[model samples]
Target: MARIYTPAQFGGYAAIVSCAAVIASVSSLRLDSAIPVVPADDVSAISRLALILPVIVAPLALGAVALLPEEINQLKSSFADGAWLAIAIVAIMQGVTAVTNSLCTRRGDFVLAAFVKVVQPAAFAGIAWLLVRDLSVALATSWIVALLVGTRAFRGLGLVSGWRDSIDACRRAWRYPVFFAPVSLLDTLTQALPLLAIVSIFGTAGGGNYSQVQRLIGAPLMLVGLAVGQVFLKHAGDLIRASTPLTPLFLRVFRNLVILACLTVVVIVFVGDWALAVFLGHGWRTDTMFLILVILPVVFRTIVSPMSSVFLLYGRIGLVALWQVSYFVVTALAVFLGRSGASLDYLLATLVCSEFMMYLTYFLLAYFLVRRVDRYQLGLK
Candidate 1:
């Protein structure tokens, strides 16, 4: 991607991706989340809701984006001329793929789930590697086509057999639409803010640089975290439904994540620049400063993000929502203060500090919730 497309082009690609992610977060109304928690008989209804909701919701998300002309333009720049619809299509695809992914996760089909994650990026990079021209448009269309990535997970499932059941499922899972969707959306927004802020402050090229920084130093480890999150959500959710203690499971995850984080930081600190130069270019390589503030928060986020499902399992939506609101406010304020000072270092520093602190608090809160559940479970035993 780096060799074929310039930083500016890559930034546009990243921007479009971030926008699609925001739309996808709420597109299924987060009904995919309920698949593991709900009764077996009800899964089909939820699957139907997952398929239909994205159609209804993705347009609304795109329409709302249309109201923000600049945001629309950022997305537009990523596609070929006369291909503006690619944005909405890709967003809908992302939402649909998310639900299918949830389906795969629910069934312990981790191999397929992992394969689905690889196909898009591999396809995008392969296409870009073949044709350097119209790089952004090619990438956009690749993602648009990737909506089919997880369709295998839907084969035995009934997505449209009973419309009435879908409605009933929607009614039953009203809390997900009302509460979980917004929290999930807020989480996506939080993840995307730094790139957006950098682009706003710097330019698309800077956004590209920041995006690659994440791809290089953060993404691989975070991919591991995400894969772990799927397993954690499944198993921890099982613990909840079975009325089993979860603190031990939570702590084991926490400990392993910490060790993995340390290993990631060590590797990145030692050979990060080499990997950056290899993947992007020597010109885009980082220095010591990047090793400290930038990498710290990346590792911090890895530890906290996966375990967050524990909160949802325990019905602690209020606390999760509060943490999300606080994270956005604090991070946005950092953006505001740094933009005012006109110092990228200050912005990055404040951003990293704020995120590290926020993630730590999130981990502690999740731990406390699980421990409380542990006490109750022991008393029952």
Candidate 2:
């Protein structure tokens, strides 16, 4: 019998995403706080290299990494020499850590995914302590260890499939990037634009603060959203392919997401600063209002988050690209122009504004697309 979704599964998924969020948030706290202290410019450079890497490196690295077949030796070797080799190494390891997280997530095992993700930051901290004196090595080792731990986690979960086969599956999933790339770019810009903008004003420290907020709110959003979104996407795809209707499923998930977002906002408003103080320390923590504002986009995201699944379900890459680009452009411009003053409040407000724009834009587009699809199916188009 197929495994039924249960409270245990929910526990597992939540545990996984929460854990991942903790690790991510804590690590950001450390990195943001650590960057200013490194004495040597070269070490700082190396550390900064580690930091600036994924902006350019992640996708290219992901592409190369995903293209390989499931040979362990081959995958390892390829990862060693790939572009942004260091970042690639980190990505590989992090990918492993997230494997079980992703699997459980796809299986509607939210708790498990959350539980698995929590280990990531702790693992990094442990490694960072070991190499704390060498900033570059510490930075590199943090990710490396995280990946090692991730691999072990995947192994423990029995999700460690052959690299060759994993790559093969990814190869088939290649069509996704056509749509995923642009959306991903827009996403990176939305989250990372503040850092870029900060270069003109307060330099790295300002960028670091912005990055921290982005990491704090954005990372959790992705993790939590990913957990639910994966399950929803898979179900929606299956239903679409089976010629079964999907509106009920979409609506139910959408409502649940909205309810979740409301609760999240309340928590962020009430305890956000206290939580940040405990987790990120006072040095890296910002205003509660700023955090609250940063979280607004998540509400919009909850509504339109599943739209890409619709795009992928119908293989509507062109429409997805167009809709996503429109959202991206509008949001980027709004955020860029809005970055005035050094206050986290202004920064977050801008970020939230951009997110809201994208949310509304994507939601409307997805709604219409779904409606059009449904009408066409009923011979009413």
Candidate 3:
């Protein structure tokens, strides 16, 4: 796709997808997070809540994006020629896919959840291969189709019915958005800003390169992290409900993730350059390889993936919110500093530093909180 399309065109596609991701994250209203924690009887209602909220929120989000000035969109490498319609479609689909996937995971249907994760990239790759002549349409169509397919897969799961129950579910869990929505918005912004900054500072070509490397490297991490995190959260919730000690399970998960992360880093260090050349074509081999190397240190912190669910289990939303805000500030500052006469390498280095700092902060905070909670519970016991 990178070879088929100009960097600006690819960057435009990336910007649209990134914007859709942010919108979807906001419209989800964090109802998905509550799916596993909420009572079994309320699961269907919560699923309905998830479906209803996005229908109400996505159009407003689309309107807001449509209202942005053309020049601003151009600077961000976004599509300004009515492509917002495609973006709107993708955003709504993404929100529905997220909720349905969460419903599957909460139902202990890990196979379905994992299949949903696999569908997007597989569909995108297949479509891009088939439509090599038109990368933009291929990319947009891939997302729309993949999300629609994934969402529809949940049809018999009883997630999308019962309007009255959905409204009641919304009323019961209204506070969910209070803590999570803002944090989710901030987190999405934090993730998307770096790509936008790359476009603004280094032009669309830079943004394209950055986005490619992000997809290449981040995809595996996302798949593994999400699968493990879902299972961990489900088990953690069960154990918490049973009043069992969580420290042992947390430690075991942490250890396994550490082993996996270490193995991944070792593989990347040795074969990463070769893999990039073989898989992504020769054009991506150099800069992408170097960027991968630069960010390898940050990959170590991926061991803390399960800690997120730990926070949710303990209802430490305040801590999670604080960490997210702090991370956004740190990442924004890094981007600002990188804009000051820095090369792409330097900018990437700053990103690595920012990611390392954020993950380190999270690990420390989660560690302390987990220990504190364990102690309190032990005292009560």
Q: For each candidate, what is the lDDT?
A: 0.78, 0.51, 0.74
TM-score for model 1? Answer: 0.93
User: Which residue ranges in model 3 land beyond 4 Å of their true spot?
Assistant: 6-8, 70-82, 151-161, 285-289, 297-301
Candidate 2: count of backbone clashes, pairs at least 3 residues apart or interchain: 30
lDDT tens readout by residue for model 1, 252-346: 99899999988887787788767667667644636656655566777888888899998778787888889999988888887788777665667
Q: Looking at candidate 1, what is the lDDT of residue 200?
A: 66
Residue 322, model 2: lDDT of 76
Q: At residue 339, what lDDT does model 1 achieve?
A: 76
Instruction: Order the numbered candidates by lDDT, best leading.
Output: 1, 3, 2
lDDT of 1: 0.78
lDDT of 2 by residue, 113-178 (tens): 555466655554465455443222333456555554434323332233344533343344444334
Best-performing candidate as measured by TM-score: 1
lDDT tens string, model 3, 1-381?
A: 655666666666777778778888988798977887887777777777776677779879878876788676555334556567767777877787888778777778888778777777787777877755555556567766666766654565465457787778777877678898888889788888888787777777777766766577766776677788888888888888887777788888888888887777677778776776677674553443465744453464457755677887788888889999998999899988878755877777787788887887787887777677777788953
Answer with 1 or 2, whichever has the higher TM-score.
1
